[model samples]
Target chain A: MIQTLEQISTIAEMRVHIKEARRQGKTIGMVPTMGYLHEGHLSLARAAKENCDVVVMSIFVNPLQFGPNEDFERYPRDIERDRELARSAGVDFLFTPEVSEMYPKPMLTNVSVSHVTELLCGKSRPGHFDGVATVVTKLFQIVQPDYAFFGQKDAQQVAVVSQMVADLSMPVQIVPCPIVREADGLAMSSRNVYLTPEEREEALVLSRSLKQAEAWLYEGVALRDIQERMIAMISEMPLAAIEYVEVLRYPDLVPVEQPTPGESIIVALAVRFGKTRLIDNLITSI
Target chain B: MIQTLEQISTIAEMRVHIKEARRQGKTIGMVPTMGYLHEGHLSLARAAKENCDVVVMSIFVNPLQFGPNEDFERYPRDIERDRELARSAGVDFLFTPEVSEMYPKPMLTNVSVSHVTELLCGKSRPGHFDGVATVVTKLFQIVQPDYAFFGQKDAQQVAVVSQMVADLSMPVQIVPCPIVREADGLAMSSRNVYLTPEEREEALVLSRSLKQAEAWLYEGVALRDIQERMIAMISEMPLAAIEYVEVLRYPDLVPVEQPTPGESIIVALAVRFGKTRLIDNLITSI
Candidate 1:
């Protein structure tokens, strides 16, 4: 007999279950996602299941993280398919709260990280990381998980969250899972649904360019030269509109002229395939 | 045999003690203070002991909550005396982390509450509530108490902290204990150490004016007229420099021209006694 997955919508109901789980000595691992479940989110859920006695996945497309002109309204969401995917992945609990349920009134609290959030997507999107940090804090308080899993596809987000937990002395471990990619080498993203067929085909340039940059770095090419080459490669795709392409120190995200020996650095990029903006990154050690 | 109070000076050690307490099915109550324990601080500890199986009081002078020109450097501290007071007050654990221990590095994460903080002390001491909110968050995460006790003498601080816990869904109840006052009606404060004999004598005017305002309110006086009379009474004190005297709704701190019947309102004031700035408030329902 297959055990049915539990769907929790309210914070109070979720806490009741969490209290009982704690009483039974169950370790909870959580995977927070903005649903439209792709292979990447499933990978995070699978990672959680491996590490914890109970796996909780929260599918909330938080409006706090979106800019005024960004795709908050049209962001892809399919709870029906997401529930099926979560069930197949062996997720024990799925927390799917409505926007009103999560935020009953105007939220007056804001959680923000300073230096680490000053680079990457943070630089482009002004208050994005503040929004992410605030909502993630609320979820962490609600679930009180032992370990939380995040996809490295959103490298900056992982870094910001790691910094927040450390700085706040929050009592959970942050496990950064590897970026999950499609067979065609394109990084899996919920926004991929918005791409035209041609734009979808051209989107593979994002990853291919990063792969080439990784090879160049291994061959002892200067970091700036590799970054320039990667940008040039992606520019060749007609539909690709490059937002940023650069090499920065891992986690800290400070710009580097040369890779320090044995230190990890990330070659991350955000490029718009027509109207859909996609981000991908590769972390390699010198 | 008298039980000796355990003094925990490190986060790791505190966590270990808290974990052991949790395993034994203890309900922990916390009172966070900045040393120089007076009757006000002791009252909170007593309240905590009454409500919880274990009472933990933390006494660390938080520099974050002080402005550059504020009394951070000269703030009073006496751990030896504090330990004796904690023992007498029935506190089980006393956490006394050094500034370096609490903030090993420059903190990157800041927790801030908006709107409700914009009035009262928040208006005069900018970024003061943000610092208070951040440190309190760190303390709450470290202690993980079943209930947290706060003195209502710092009414705005209580409001800000209560708002943060509710907004963040933090799993601790905020218990606001009544303000412990001197026989002469001056509110107890650690900063009272900074008061000269003349200033100490003059400080009684603050509470006296509030009492007059309360009587006027009882007589169906308008809120604005009561505020003007209170300000005038305080102005008569030769050494007093009034920062603000406000008549606002309780908890929310929104300005109110007149109190709604059956609703609580606060008549709050901040004044400088020579170099020492002190705050006090009276909350009553119409």
Candidate 2:
């Protein structure tokens, strides 16, 4: 892979270019993203480059995924900087479709996955998963890549998308990359820019408490006690408003009443630092 | 394309065979059916033979599409006879996945299309289009055919599936096949076996009423009057229990109050002959 990255916008062009690459028997790996390049997004591009002959990165701030009150209009976007980063990261094709091109008319079709969507972030945001499922489905159809990558930072999103692909028998593989974090342990997110310096420092308590909870796992504390302890620790930071701090089973996202043999648990958190919400999780096996 | 027809029953084998066919640059066309082997199904296979290098016929009586009171158990099946019929129709591959193979687990994913699904058969059958969309989506993913064929006899079904493919941007093209009828004018259906010889003759009122309504469409009569006339005609046949006789806009399935200039209308009817329910429709551009 050279630095000769081709930028394709329209779905028609993307299909035509992909068909040519497919004719030549090139394997495709896609990293779907909302623009404004971050080190975490670049990490996805790196993984795709390593696995497949061609890497396509899509950068559209999907309106469908944003709630009415969420940051749809204020979401960060830098196409020029994104282009530079993608070129240096050895992206073969960059797809950046206009919103109108993506949805010219009112969308009447929706892809919904049950059971997996009724928990986590799906609890607070009513239609978030529906939007995510719908857009991710459209992207999968448009790209038709052999492998698609997502960040484990959004663990529930990964779970919902994986369920959709599996239940539908979609002919694509979903690759979950580990969450990238700051040196201070804050998970990298586009919304992190909304935090003040003081709020950012206070947000470190989220990871600190999670790491402490990881220690409690080996001690065989009850799941509720562990959750209460983490909640108490976060309450010390006045700037951090805890939305949810849950320790649930992996992939299924079901609440684990007690630790069992060979069971895996994910200690997940969602806390707001001023207006920005940050999420992070730590996985452990018992 | 050849005299030798191959039969596949598993998803793994189907993928392997289709991948190889696609690798050789063969355009595939699929005909999805419930496997009773009638002239209507043969028409789809013949159209597939004319358009594509390989024709695949999938025979699965999807239980998800049937209601609790509906006849799912006694739907009909004869693999040996269907194999011979598919072979005679020049099918390159016959996919007959077992129910367990198709639904190893309870399906958690559902694909839904709005507007088009709220009327016609959708009004009478709740969750019917949802099942159709879900199963059709799974088939499209498993086969990844270049084109898929459906009988226009189920005009509402064609509309639902077409909307789903368009909304999801699935890569396969949907081909609508013309409805093939018997010499006596009753529409060909797998459930027609349930009809007794005398009941079969009475069932002709379904097509007869629809054909009469088609004439009224060009005569500039109000759409409601045509629907009322169709209902009266079907009422005369005691064996034919009328379910619905609606004249609606094409694709959208919206009820039309009056005839519009140069607009397409679908004169649709659903009637039951004894225990079997039959549906038929005729489209005319006025």
Candidate 3:
């Protein structure tokens, strides 16, 4: 039997519950997501459940993170389905605040991380990471969680958040979980549902190119050579339009001319299959 | 008898103490300041003492808030003197993190309040509020105070911080204390020490002009006329070089043509007496 999960729609109510739990010596964990739960999101929830006495899962389809022409309106959301899944995953409280609830007035405040945000999805989407950073900062304050879980599917996001936590001296610990994947090896994303059958087939190259890049790294190939090959292979796909295929130093996202021994490297890629965009990455050390 | 206040210079050490205080159910109040404690700062600490079980005062002159041409190096510092003052004021902890301790790395993350920071001292100091907001944010995270205190002398700063707290849903209450002043009616500031004795006497015009402005408001003067009159009064002082003298809506700092019966208005001014710049303001309800 699925347990009934408590749903909180306002930050005030969630804070009260969190405060009570905190007073009772219960360790709190949080998972912040833009709804439409996938295996990747569930993995984060499971991690929170395993580690925390109380787990809070917030499903806010943040409009701030999307660009003017991007998928803000079309971002997938299923509240009932999310509620059931969160209950099954042992979320003690599911905070689902409306856009108005989160942003009661015009938000003049912004939290942004430079350098780390200038590349990857941040480059393609202006003000995206600033929105993500601001909302995540708000959630961190609202939830006041001891630990927060995030999937490594968005490696750059994890890096940005980690930098923020370190820079701000925020008390919460960031736990980056491994990316979950489909049976066909495509990285699980909420946007994956937007892909057509043929588009989905074409999108698999994102993950495939990362795998190829990883193999090249193991074979002692140069970083530039691996990036070129990955781009070449992905470009061969009729529908794939490459956004960026980069091999950079991990966490910092600085350009790495050559990977040194024991230094971590991330081979990340973003591509568009027709109108739908997909991203995938692999982390390895030389 | 003066009690010895614990001085914390590192974020990690501060957090340990804050966490323990929190666990003990002691309400924490913080007074963040740029050292060289004056009556203004002590007033905030005393207010914290009155309201909280534990009072933590931080005395770091944040370099981030200082512009290239600003007096970062000569800001002011007397650790031993500040310690005695804080102890006498009933502060439990006095955080005095060094520049290196507070900013071990070049901070890439910035917290900014946009529209609110476009005027007043924020206008004169280009990245001033961003630096203030960012450092205050870091301190809030480190101290996790139940209440943070600020003096209304820095009225725009109070407004910016209040806006950030409300917008981000930070769980700390911002308590704005009444402006503390010298017997001569000069606003207490660390930088007041920078003034020569002659300049100090000339600085009296700032408060006097503000008084004139307040009187004009009561006599049914238009906002513009009152502002112009205040400017003219300050300009009469041979030593006073006015940077700005204006009347605007309180907190939001938007322009006001005329004061409505219930509207709060702020008559704020910034001026230079030789090389020393000073700011003073008065808040009044029409």
Candidate 4:
């Protein structure tokens, strides 16, 4: 059964929806998305449904996170399709606010982390994480969720949000789920739809390279050697334009030379499949 | 009836205190203070007690806010005295965590605000607001207050915190209470105890200048004329070295060239009474 909201246009409206849900003694779980729904998002919704009484999925293709040259306009968005998928995933509430509604005017405020934000995806995209941090913060406030779910596809983003929650002492708990992948082992992402048949095949290198690195690490390969091998393999792919490839501490996402035993390490990368950017990561205790 | 919480040295212990209070269905209000409590802090504590079922006052002289040359070491410390003052003011809990306890080893996170933090007190004391923002963010997380009380003594601080809450969408409401003053109109502060007899007399000029500005504004004087008069008055007090005397929009605390009706204006000043620096403000709707 599909439930449709009146399309909340302001933070106040969103609050009214959450307030009513809370009055029913319902726990809210939020899944914030940029609006092109796929299995990855559905997986998050299912998790939210299992953990919370009411699940709210926010479809806002946040413009603040995109640079001038980045695909803010061309970003994949299908509200009707997303709504149908969310309904099937057992999502109780769907919040799709307009860009103007989210950012009524040019915003003067921004949330930023010092060192962690300057690495990985942040190294290439200047204000990208700042944009992500700002929007997620706004969503957290609007939804007032008990728990927020984010797919591991954007590992750096998950790490960034975790750090933000810890640093700012935001009350919401960030639940980072495992990466949802396709049959070919490629991470499920809306950008995957942007790939041509040829580019789609080339995008496989992202996950494959990380898997290879993991195998090498298990076989006693050093951290620097593993990263060098992964970079070489991705560089060899014709359609895979590597943006960044690094090994960092999981959760904190800080660059580390060697992983300590019991410490989680994230081997992550961002690659361009045609004009679309795809990110993937492999987490393991080293 | 004075109630004293045994000094909790860990975040876990502090959370237990908060959780136990909540289990009993008590709403928490927090007053984050650096020890060496004065009338100003007691006023905030009283406000917190009136507003919340449980008042948890944290007394930690945050080192991060102090510059290297600043007197962080010599600032002050009278936790026993502070506990008495808080208990007398009807506080339910007093959290006095050591710096090491609050900032356990391997602390790498900091919170900062842009634009708003770059002016006023932030201008003279670099990274000062960042320290305040970071520690306050931690306190908000640790105590999880329904309402937090701050004094108008630190005018720019109230402005920075208000902006932080709006920007981060923090769940807590920030209450800015009126500045408590001495019979001679000198703003009461923890640092007031550091003032010598001669310096204490000169400190009266800070409030006197503000009163002078208020009288001029009441007489239908322009903002510029009032500022010029106050600046001249402050300059005459030899021991009262002026840092800044500017008028700004109230609450939002934005600097304004012309006053607007219905919008509040704050005439704030920071001056040195001997080696001790003091700040004060008078907030009024124009």
For each candidate, give the TM-score of chain B: 0.99, 0.98, 0.98, 0.95
Considering chain A alone, report the TM-score of candidate 3 relative to the true chain A: 0.98
Give per-residue lDDT, candidate 4, residue B252. 62
Question: Model 4: residues >4 Å from true position, as ranges?
Answer: A1-10, A16-28, A249-263, B1-9, B20-26, B105-107, B252-255
CA lDDT of B39 in candidate 3?
Answer: 89
Ranking by DockQ: 3, 1, 2, 4
Worst 10 residues of 2 chain B by lDDT: B255-264
In model 3 chain A, which range of ten residues has the least summed lDDT? Answer: A1-10
**TM-scores of chain A, one for each prediction:** 0.98, 0.97, 0.98, 0.95
- What is the interface root-mean-square deviation of candidate 2? 0.9
Specify the poorest-scoring 10-residue window by lDDT in model 2 chain A.
A117-126
lDDT of 2 by residue, B1-286 (tens): 4578899999999999998888888999999999998999999999999999999999999988888988889998889999999999989899999989988988888888899989878888888888898899899889999999999998999998888888777888999999999998989998889889999889888878877887887787788888888888899988878888888889788877875777788988888888988999998888
- For residue B106, model 1's alpha carbon misses the true position, in angstroms, by 1.3
List, for all models, the DockQ compared with the true complex: 0.85, 0.83, 0.89, 0.38
Q: On residues A1-286, what C-alpha lDDT tens digit does candidate 3 reach at each position?
A: 6566899999999999989998888999999999899989999999999999999999998989999999989888899999999999989999999999999999999999999999999999999999999999999999999999998989999999999999998999999999999998999999999989989998888888888888889899999999899989998899889999999999899998889889999999889987788888898897
The per-residue C-alpha lDDT of model 1 at residue B102 equals: 90
- Residue lDDT tens for model 4, B1-286: 5365455656778888876775566788999899798888999999988889988888888889999988899988987787778888877778887887777644446667777766678888898988898889778877878799998888788888888777655668999998889899988888888999989988888888888888887777888888888988888878878888888777666777777778788898788877898888898875
User: Against the true structure, what is every candidate's RMSD?
Assistant: 1.1, 1.3, 1.2, 2.9
List model 3 lDDT by residue over B1-286, tens digit each. 6566999988889988988998898999999999899988999999999999999999989999999998998887999999999999999999999889888998989999998888889889999999999999999999999999999999999999999999999999999999988999999998999999999998998888888888889999998988888888888889989888878998899997887888899999999999788999999997
Q: After superposition, how far is residue B143 of candidate 1 from its true place, in Å?
A: 0.9
| Model 3: residues with Cα > 4 Å off, grouped in runs | A1-4, B1-4
Q: What is the lDDT of candidate 3?
A: 0.92
